[model samples]
Target: MARSARLAAQGLAIGLVVGLLTLLVWRVANGNGKGVAQALADGEHPTAPAFDLSRLDGRGRFDLASLRGKKPIVLDFWASWCVPCIHESRRLEAARKEYGNRVAFIGVDTKDFSGDAREWQKKHGITYPSVHDGSGSVLTKWGGLPIPRIFFVARSGKVVGELIVEEDLPRYLREIAAS
Candidate 1:
């Protein structure tokens, strides 16, 4: 009986340690230090995940496949409340001005309210269309673990570039254009 009690105590201790470790890992992985996005941009060409969501412009649904034949599209995952996203939005608007018909810009507001996203668009003078992924379902598929992520999908229907920093954004766009 004493041996059984010792085993039970050991099992409980192990479970508590595991639970604490998991919480620590979660905090580190999803913290504001730019985790998965940076690793992905530096590592490899992640498989383009299917993203289907409703456009904020009420122009029906926006499916990733449907934007294939058009110009290269940049799908930016952001939220209205994120400061970095605000900066990224300005850069995206500049890109739109520069490329015009040569490129398409789409913003996905993850886990955000529709009113806030719409207000942000108006405040920022964003001419491009945006969609809300409030449920984070599409975000998970796109592998967007954090806010302020950018995916540059080439005209040939391939995600050739991604950027995590505002400084690297234009460079990525230039690379996409050259490619």
Candidate 2:
């Protein structure tokens, strides 16, 4: 009986490990094979993945493709529960003052309740329009998890870069704004 129990424990452990590995493989093999962040890191200027989602402000659905070639975009990925998002989002709000006419500042509220997200926007004084990404599917295409992943897209719909430092916000904004 003791030997049988040991064998069963080992089997279960192996099964768990296999399951986790399979999950990781599936995630990497799926539509997120090379996420925007990875592509940017590889020095590839990939076209922005399109997504149409309902705006949190009840302004109806916003199709990202609609803005292609017409304007540059500052895409901010955030969540209501993420504390750091507050600071980053507020910084964006401040930046909007100077670039509001030249660039579109859009937010993706990922993996959070729309109601809470709306309240967060109002509380934080974030006036930029945002879309609800409750399923995080759009976030996955860009970069998953670790909220506040900001990306800059040129007027041609090509992703320029992702924010890695505070200075990057202004630098990418200038680059994309000129595109």
Model 2, range 82-161, lDDT digits (tens) per residue? Answer: 99999999999999999999999999999999999999999999999999999999999987988889999999999999
Against the reference, the lDDT scores of all candidates come to 0.77, 0.95
Q: What is the C-alpha RMSD, rounded to one decimal, of candidate 1?
A: 5.4
Q: What residue pairs clash in candidate 2, if any at all?
A: none
TM-score of each: 0.71, 0.84
Q: What's the lDDT for candidate 1?
A: 0.77
Number of backbone clashes in candidate 2? 0
**Which residue runs does candidate 1 get wrong by more than 4 Å?**
1-42
- The local distance difference test score of model 2 is 0.95
